[model samples]
Target: MRDIYAGSTEVIVWLGESGPKDHLGEMILPMLTADEIASLYQWHGDRRDLPKLAAYVSKVVEDRRKTGSAQDSIDIFGAFYVLSALISGVEASGIQELRHLHKSGPILRGFDALMQPRWWSRAWVVQEVVVAQSVTIRYGKLSAPWKIFSQAASQYERARLEANADSTYPYLKEQSLARFSRMILEIETTRNDWNQAEPVGLLSLLRKFRSRSSSDERDKVFALLGLVRFWRINEKKIMPDYHIDAIKVSFETTKSLLASVGSLSVLAGTLRYSECCDSNPSWVIDWNYPPTTNEDTRLFNLPWYCAGGSDGLIELHKQRVLKIEASYLDEVISVGEELVETTITRMRPVIMDWTKLCAQFIDTRPSFEHAHYIGGGSVGDAFWRTICGNLEFVKMGVNTSNFATTTVKKGFRKATADGSLAFEQLRSADYSHRRTTSIIGGFWQESNQPDPEIARRNAFHHAVECACEGRRFFVTKTGYIGVGPRNMSVGDHAFIPHGSQVPFILRNADRLVACQGDQIETLSSATGSQPTYIPAGKHAKAPEQQKVCYEAHSELYFVIGDAYVHGVMNGEAVRLETQAFWKTTSICLI
Candidate 1:
């Protein structure tokens, strides 16, 4: 199907209430109606519609011109006439307005050449390479790169000279470009001063932009300042070895000399020590030991130094002090407690599931080797006891309900007062917290499981656990009932503790009755433990019977593989990514 306005050349025709075409003879009425022509100009944001309208106008103009009609009678044929007619029609139709016309304005303006048609016939972009060669002819012998650039420049000159006997270099009119080129010639001039201060080219560029008179130019100057600030803060972090490279002075050094010096010039002295500085030097508040009140002067590490005196340094210090004193001081004190609770909550299911599974695996191992590591003598029993204790706690809905609230309220003070040695170990002078220690103990024992293999398997297991907990694990009890809410029952869900009973009641079409409570005795294997069942009432509706929930088993676990390890021997060490015990399959039994 061909588009209505497919051709490169466009013609537009518009009809208003007072169109000139109303005077046309009845002979031409069958070929075109003014109403139909007006409807053709009605369109949305489309540029194609304009051309379609234009084509119809061109036909009318041709018809009038061939008839020897006066140019005044043919005003509809002019490009601007066609444009105004189309705009007015679109506005009248309520389909569009002039404000929406900007999108196609530039394209429409370019179409003025279309009236001639011949000039725009060829494709615009031609295949040609622009060869740019910059040469820095230092006062003495040029460096290899400079020499090569000079040679290329000379060759370009020779080729131009050959191309024309009478030649001129047009760029000579820009005297700054010539000055820039000559400066590149003096490379060796500042070779000795290169490392003594910041590069002059960078400084010069900053100065030029900083001193600009126009608002746009000043904006660019501020942008440069912001970039410098970013570089100063992040240089050590992003490129720790950047300062190691020696300065390579060349004739191009003059470009550095051209930059105007500002506040950044003061940074040159401090920059000397930046190579040894830390990227993120956190402030440590030793709450246990107050700052020596006896001392009049105290020296502390500041990430930035003052260019002037104590006032400048103190002002910067006060800004940070006020900021912390205003908001983060209390927040910092509070976050430790918050993090402690958050960590436990996040690790809850993981710890539960892992510990339980470790016990299960220990209980049902196919061979002695599987049992030897986690099993041995009391280890197996100790693990089983732990799992049972925890599982029963869950089935009984026994958790630190008020315990968490109390802990958070008490804050780190509890941990501090209780003498948790881990906190003190973290505070050891020999331990730099910046270099993180993954394992407080040492590396994982070489289980029959391959190192990477164990990690990959454990990751999949952990992901599954996280997914299940995210969706199904209940955070609150609403429909719960029991002797102190001992259990929860979803229909068909297995019960862990024996003795819990579920009672179901039907209440017409509008409501249902349910009751949950403890059982007289738990179903038990004389040798082990049994899962309990909650019976439904005989009067319960068939669908209502489905609402009866039995107590669910508490099954969650954690295996202890060392999470991090450091070595005192030979300064060598290994770390296991997962601190888990279960390997999932016999292939991971190693």
Candidate 2:
């Protein structure tokens, strides 16, 4: 299918108002009413005195043409020119006015039709649209080039982002962007980026469109093989084979990715106690759904830190096992309340509770009226950096005097506070009782200057939310603070795999089976207090009567996803003073 689509000179797409149930895709030229077309052009085009709308659209089209996109297609440009004029007009007139306008009913109706179509959300559509040479979208006889839709979506995205700081810049609002059109724009960009040899990878694409629908789970992997770069696969293409089991596709993809991607950043997994998820091997990526958890910057581990350093160890075994050398960190002894509620309204109280938890271990509080991180190594600094994993602050466009950094030591280039702004509010969350004090505290008026405290708080709040999504705030036995997946247990160990960008939490897989397996016996190992397990079927003979009695101590571990432990984020694990308990060892993950 991909080869056919890729070889085609032009592909015509029947974008019906709805799915197959209405048979909109089968509509002929007569199906589109002349009145609907006229109504759309009038409401979206130059109605009267709004020259700015036309000017904005013209400028957007011109810029797109400069980028060699639909440069020769005047029809495409004209279509986009009118679409964005109205979509942007949504911001000026407000969504309520444009959405409810009787004269503009056709365009809104068109958007309504475009929103819920089955074609837009299907996983295979990614391959069809991306591989094709030229594409045209048709709603009955009313047709518009695919370039027009892509341009319109990109313009809406730009306007929506710009409107954030300026409330009056009524260009476009979020609601006006068609849901399916977003998928088109994304695939176009993916194709462009991949062709240009950008840093895009199969994992990134898989997670980006993971929500896309597909009847066969195997198609999720097969559909992407066409677009995935050969370099990411060790120059070996993953050919499709219907004979292969759907489960093996995941295992093969994971193993291939882990082998090729170098870093263990591909090792993302979860034990979703809340949902009825697949019982896949802990190392395999279940692509049918996205990762239950995300680490730094939505699973793209930021390059600022190298937690595991230069050491690299990867070993694939028979029976679906992965072994890697990791440095033992510590055990999670205490954890704060799980923050599952994701909303700005609920964020304050949730963070406040987490702050209180941090205060419990590090009782002493220092004044951070101006400084965020202490120059000397302090538990307070670790607590702050740990919770704010992947501050992602560099590109966040947040401005503050407190965005300050200093070298913690003379020869060490790494700063104590690399990329965090430890504002007074963040510092006082533990001790200050002023819950609703204005961000400036009436002090900014004295200087007659704006306060960036609100900005800092907003950024920090967002960072904490990103770092803790689908995860629980945990404190280790040695007083290290961080967030881990919800399934991280009290006795589970944290380790920084030699080549991984971030630390991870993994527990003895055999022990997990002993505790939770349907038929298993937990026994004490002959060597001290280490856990030993023996499996027995529910229908099998009694354990005493079993002929094969053997102490099973499988060193296999079920990997809990990546972590954001503060101290070890920047190669601290590699440079740690050699200790007996925190030494390196080979860990086998199942």
Candidate 3:
């Protein structure tokens, strides 16, 4: 199919009647220059280390800021002006000149509307469009190059992120257009990525398009098979077989990829990434679930650490039970509030509650000068980083990205470094104000800084919010501070699989497999963690606090997705090399 499509002269994509293709000529093109449109697309995905390209893009934006061309202003503000004139009951002729300014709003809501077409999301459409020799998108009678829609979607997203600085409309920015920008740009990027003529692995394709729209559940894997260049050796192993069940296809595909690639990376795809995650094995990647991960964010593509230690043994028994060597870190002893949503109202309370939770384990003074933890960082530094999952936003397109970990956590770090002000401030009569304002005020207050830092701050805030949005703050039995999945519990554990880059949270699969027909398997490698395996049909009468409760759980655990433990993040856990403290052992996962 790919070869045939590539040989074709041209592919004319009909993007329905209301998509960006229809509005490209009259609306989007009028507002943005060719360079700006290209720049929008370039910034659509992850930040590649392209110094020359990034510099060129910076120049274009600077030029636009310096010279907002007459047409640009008219195109931007003309729609609102034209609408107001009509509301005032002006003559139609008087409004005629400014009426065309209707195109001006394309930078805002108009562009969002243009991205509304369903064609951009169709999973089956990818191979045809991407493999084609040349492509154009048409809507109704209007036709435009595919580049117009592909690139335009990213600009609206960039604008949406920048607009959050308007505190009044911060909620509005969160609610609208930003998601559409993400969707279209992802679709566009995959298409462009395939055009590079590189042979992509099947695992990459599965992760990349996991959230894409597909009418048939099986199409999620089948549709991407043509693009899997690395799977030719095992091509017969994973061919499209519609006769098979969708869940079976998904389950088999996971095994096939792991077998072919010979890596444990796919373990990261389970639990959080799987949809209908209930019935399937905790280790399998269900295609139905939208793996809504931000690849460009903190968890991935950052300064990676090998906290998983050295790879040892990886075996799949009956191609069902996932047995691998993982360094067992700590069981979650206490669970803090789960940050359920990404709203301005919820963010403050969640962070505050988390801070209080940290306070239980360590000190947070009025001046916040304390450090008693695993990694040797100050108390304040550990608290803030753990809450945000140890993430900072860099390369956020128009939003500045140079805000370093040292720079971001320094003010809070300073509070930890010096206890001189702490005692005096506590003794002062105005200690109440000093206590409250010194910590949260310094961290959370909205800054009206100069433009660039404001964008950087907004981006930073967004990174923290998004990173912790659906996760809960957790304290390990060993006094480690971190954040895990929303559904994580007190007995759930955090570990680093030998081959994985980040730590993952997992819960005992005892009750999880009780409902399913899976057999209980004890998975441990010399840790004296030989907990009694209670069959799925049986019950453990002990409560969570009791040893026989979930705490004395077996090695077989269900994944709760990736996590950020402050001490373990930078590989100190691996460095310690003490089995009793943190053991590198084999554990079973569903």
Candidate 4:
């Protein structure tokens, strides 16, 4: 049987539940090694990883029992063993700092200032120290609790020696002792308080700060302060000296948030960039170095929501960005190649009369006439904050290279391109002169290259466009159609019905109305009013209520049939349909 190490939450709760016995199991439990258990526990999972103490309390207690020789030491050690085991799980949680010896319980209580010098004098403190040191050694990381006790003991000993100095003046001696005593108390108190604070709460506070009003400078200040505290606690114990750089990155992020020049939305962009460092950033997909293609890498280009992580949307976006490199792009474009092959084989002639339909015209214009390839927004600047901060798809597009663009643009320019571009053009066109600029448009190896199947479709569309202009025929092709805010920032792409010439309609400030093949009126359109239509309207929608219907949860989707049916089935959709049609006249809905 393979041994499995519990996740963070499980580790802590396990320690609390199993106490010393589980600790023994974790140490001596054979199917896996200590290092393997540690690795498994460290990997991100459904819960937090267990701390050193909680994960190895049994080892600590057993070590004391084996080594300590004196009877009084043994008695005190026994008491220490019980208390340490009880708190091991909490220490393992890694989410909270567990420092206060006083509040810790009767067996492991705080040491008095006068009793600090002689370890033999205070049997309780000695027993607790022995257990704590043992746990720390086994765990390998020095936590806040370990530091507090260690520092307090050292300071108390030093203070006592000073008090005994013969040359020491009465007034000075008293003041020095008082100051030393106060310092020890303060450190101990702070350590306890630090441990009690929650990591989740700290993250929540940071997010809230990002969401707060930009105009409220004080709010930004308060947020920064909270972040500082969060990092400071980690500095003391949460992370080791080697990992301290992560805290520094977080601090720098706070500084950028403070200096950011835009609204709350803008500030969010600054904070987002800060999250990308090796430390706290939720996910990191190194596109430059592609790994063996797996489910993890395959979903890299999907939206963050579908990507598994602490937060769905954010994770998906991060993955898409990282996968924008050559290898990932190659994989996605290959999928597109499959799309071309499938669409070509399935192409059919139009049988419906064009003149029979009634056209309701809603005069609408494209939000932007041209797609500006804004590249390279400052990784952590205020300008990026103003525009694309909280914009989901823009983050998705920017992160994934999904939006059609060649150049990189940063800050307000990125924001402008992301939003309406109405705001951007108004400010300046010389994006080249800006502090951060990347080339706008040119060619990607996979996307720019023309495939025979894709070329045929493009030619078909061009032929149709030429006919619409040269002749009076307002011919509508069979595919999907959508209309609304027509922005990913505002609306979702809606599937239009087959053989429908439709007018664009804006549902509201946030939503778009989509008419699916003229069958139902519940589609969301703000994305585009193309000739495309989704095929699996029945499967896509629940039993009834097309408007308030079922949702698709698959990572990839497919564009099938003459009417563009884009849902859960992607490259597989093409294969499924192609294989089925050759065998039967009855079309099977996938």
Candidate 5:
């Protein structure tokens, strides 16, 4: 079977039973290996030739190794897994079931079953399906091209989005059905042909499938090696080293990436200390761990304003130290004792009181008085935008044309006639409510129809949902407003490290200790002071003491989180004129 698949021009898969199963006592079983059994558990129904299929694939890969080419097309025999069921002569009742509200449950269940195949979760599936020249999924006795299935899935996803935005479409509100369709659609779309002229970056490709699983942890990185564009250049260095441990692989991969790019920008993916395994270095990000929050902000291409330097450059030394060009910012004098988690409800109130929050900090730390220092108009605005989940609205100003501007202005005037309304009211609820109401009114007004109060409510709910999620905030001791991870503590220092777009949180590396009596007397003797009453022959060898060392220049620290430091955000952190004189030094991260 392996020899046949390796040399054949085409391959076929029968989703149905390939042969009769043997019954031993009361138990009926099919022959398969332990590895094969583990891999196929998620596959819903019996597939007797599953072992043969695995061998055929292995043989095909082996043949490619010897001849540089292998058969890339496969024709499946059964329609059970296919989107269309007519080929199997299974009654075409699923689609009809979707039309009736009562039958939608069974239809959704059938869709889910179709997508339950372990095939999607396999690591090898990425290379196989992506590199394939053609794939035909058979429905029972009927057949259709893979493109049809892909298009149908895509259409369903788009319809789902539309249904979510416009609540009028009841049929499209079937979330489970749409989700199942999307799962299949993504499999079709995410494939890379590898024959294209341009290729994606290794990091980008890895991030795309970071959520995928493998029985062996190392396979998470090894499986994607073939898809990496720089594999040829880095082959000798990063070749599949399954013999090594997962931690070593992670460190080596990160080191290679830093050396290749010559920048600390790669560290943007690093999460708060509380969020990651404490054993891993501050610079190393575990790609296997699923991302929790602000994933988009952590991307390589940060906004220009946030980056301290124009060029993303750094020096890699001995595979342990990173020397980057940066300006030094002020040390954190104080930080809030309480740490706020970035959960849903917690985030909402933070956004609602964004201005009041900043005011509380500004009263103590007056240095952050400058508006437009970091993209947003004011410090309050910057903090608000930083914590706001929807970057689209923050980056691009709200659309006012959709609202009745005159009406909104008049309403505000009437409400504030007594002049007792707080600024927070204008910025949070009132602002979003007015804009949302205007958009909904615009839709109805243009059509000259009665107001759709339900549509208005939906719009408002969507606005609130988008506004309150993602970032964690904190306040400093001197009344400075700092925005960072929820796990931040009182002593965490905020620094605008050079080359980075935003300020980073850092912690003290050394601890202070008190010594008394003989320990202190020994320290005094070591300083060339003779002990007045030294015992005979008791030459005091000064106790080995950890001395405090201070550098005239800057010190390196552990990066804990990103922040929006008030006064130091601009050129004040690192002097631009003397930037050339800035020495490159190694920061030892334990």
Candidate 6:
């Protein structure tokens, strides 16, 4: 392969078949040994693996040099990994996959198989394809550039998302297409030569490729080592070490990252115990499970007041515990269990269903004060705003003044006053007012007759979709409202530890004994045993007895979920004056 790159070899040909064409104008099949066939199918014969294979070829060539052989080194192979006759020439464009066809039709069946190849999920293929100088995909005699393949994959994804959005679209088998699209898009983004001024951080990269598979679990980190830039001065600690176990590798990588970044932002990749305990530490993120919800979206959209200070650091002690420099905030005095809820299997064009869900939540409120307490504002006002999807009306530049004067808000106010309005009636009134307003002064005034009412309804539906889908909505014992992952249990604590951006759901580590796998169980389980005083080198200690008391210093909590507590988002729900002072603390996670 290096010879080809060095202009020594003219070209390297790859044959799809070993036998010659038959006299009847059909190719004669070659009998292949199991080993030969298995080798051919390895890595799905992807073109992206060529560069890594070339490295091995280079090693062999160097060995020949030491032997003083007469043969010239084959520096480059200019290789092509071909898939022969995978798709018919007529249907190769993939447009037919979007159309309705017979359930067992051959065309759709073949396309499904083509899209579902394991090659798309392999960790090695990510680097191979991204680093390759050139690639050409051949399907029998028909050929397409890699660029063309990528564009097609993107189009397929857009079509799939559109189909999912429309209730009228026929049922489509989209798993294969979706997987292929994500793989190709990742290759496009991760290439070193790609002109990205600001590279994605390690946390974002890990989250993005979490679902990619690896035969050896540790390769999940090792394969991407080449792509991780040493952006931070201390990030140089992220070096590839194939010798270590997967668990140690994960811990070390996270420790190095935390040391370099100096923030708990790394916890953005953390998952629920049930989802990650088998493969990852209690504190380290498991980058194998794909995210079920848009936690990143919430992270970016959070109000500025929730931002944490920079005086935070993480210490890994004895390779089993994490000592964090954090401010001690509120403790979880009480919490409720997970709510029994229905998943949104498909997108609904109307917002009525979501409005009813919100109304049900309002009805669960213990008192009028609880409503205003959950989300900052009057109980009636918060209820109406959430129902109307007007929580960010001013920030989003929507006409809230007009919205306030609309019949929708008036009827909602009347309902609160009379205490007789049903959720269905409130929805109907909101829709009626929106439609009337759109017809009077909205885009409908033009001949195009654009339905702003539909847009408004869709916007409301989208907001609820993001807030509720794949999420668990829970109420604290004191009537505080927050949403977390669906796996959240009744006893999980909602805590806003100081120096943390958002509230985190915590579980008692002691109770996790039954579920802790052998690997995690070996780690320390005592949260109280972590050292309370700073090490001698980092800070001077007071007199022996005057040193901070272990119990009085700080408390640690397990991070279960990143929460969106309605009343606490603005920092008004929990007052700092009443709580303990913000002191650096250590959270012991197994």
TM-score for each of the candidates: 0.12, 0.66, 0.66, 0.15, 0.54, 0.57
Ranking by TM-score: 3, 2, 6, 5, 4, 1
Candidate 1 vs candidate 5: the lDDT winner is: 5
- Write the number of the candidate with greater lDDT, choosing between 1 and 4: 4
TM-score of 5: 0.54
- List residue ranges in candidate 2 displaced over 4 A: 18-113, 139-142, 152-185, 197-200, 232-236, 269-279, 292-297, 337-341, 366-384, 393-465, 510-554
lDDT tens digits, residue span 328-390, model 6:
334333233332222223433223333344444455355543445444565544443332223
Error of 3 at 68 (Å): 28
* Model 2, span 36-148: residue lDDT tens: 43433222223431432333235453354235323222232222334655344343233322322131233333355554567877888887787788877766444556765
Regions more than 4 Å wrong, model 3? 18-113, 154-166, 173-175, 232-237, 260-263, 269-279, 293-303, 340-346, 361-369, 388-391, 396-450, 511-554
For each candidate, the alpha-carbon lDDT, in order, equals: 0.20, 0.53, 0.53, 0.22, 0.41, 0.42
The 10-residue segment of model 5 with minimum total lDDT is 20-29
Tens-digit lDDT string for candidate 3 (134-167): 7776545444455544554544444434333434
* Best candidate (score: TM-score): 3
In order, what is each prediction's RMSD in angstroms?
A: 37.2, 12.8, 13.3, 28.5, 18.0, 16.0
lDDT of 1 by residue, 1-590 (tens): 01222222332211113234212222233344576444342333235345534543465643643464432331222322223343343211111211122212222221232222221111110000001122221111111123322222222222211111011111111122222222222222222223243322323223222212222222222222211211211011111122232221111121112111111111111111111122211111111111111010101101111211111100011111100000000000000000111111243444344334344333435432234432122333232222111111111112446555534220111211112122122122222222432322221111121233222222222222222221111110111111101111122111111110111110111222122432211111112222111221232111100122233212211100000000100111101112232111110000
Candidate 6 overall lDDT versus native:
0.42
lDDT of 5 at 441: 18
Worst 10 residues of 2 by lDDT: 522-531
Which of the two candidates, 2 or 5, achieves a greater lDDT against the reference? 2
- For residues 242-276, could you state the per-residue lDDT of candidate 4 as single tens digits? 33343444443332321121111111111222123
Candidate 4 vs 6: which has more TM-score: 6
CA error at residue 534 for candidate 3, angstroms: 45
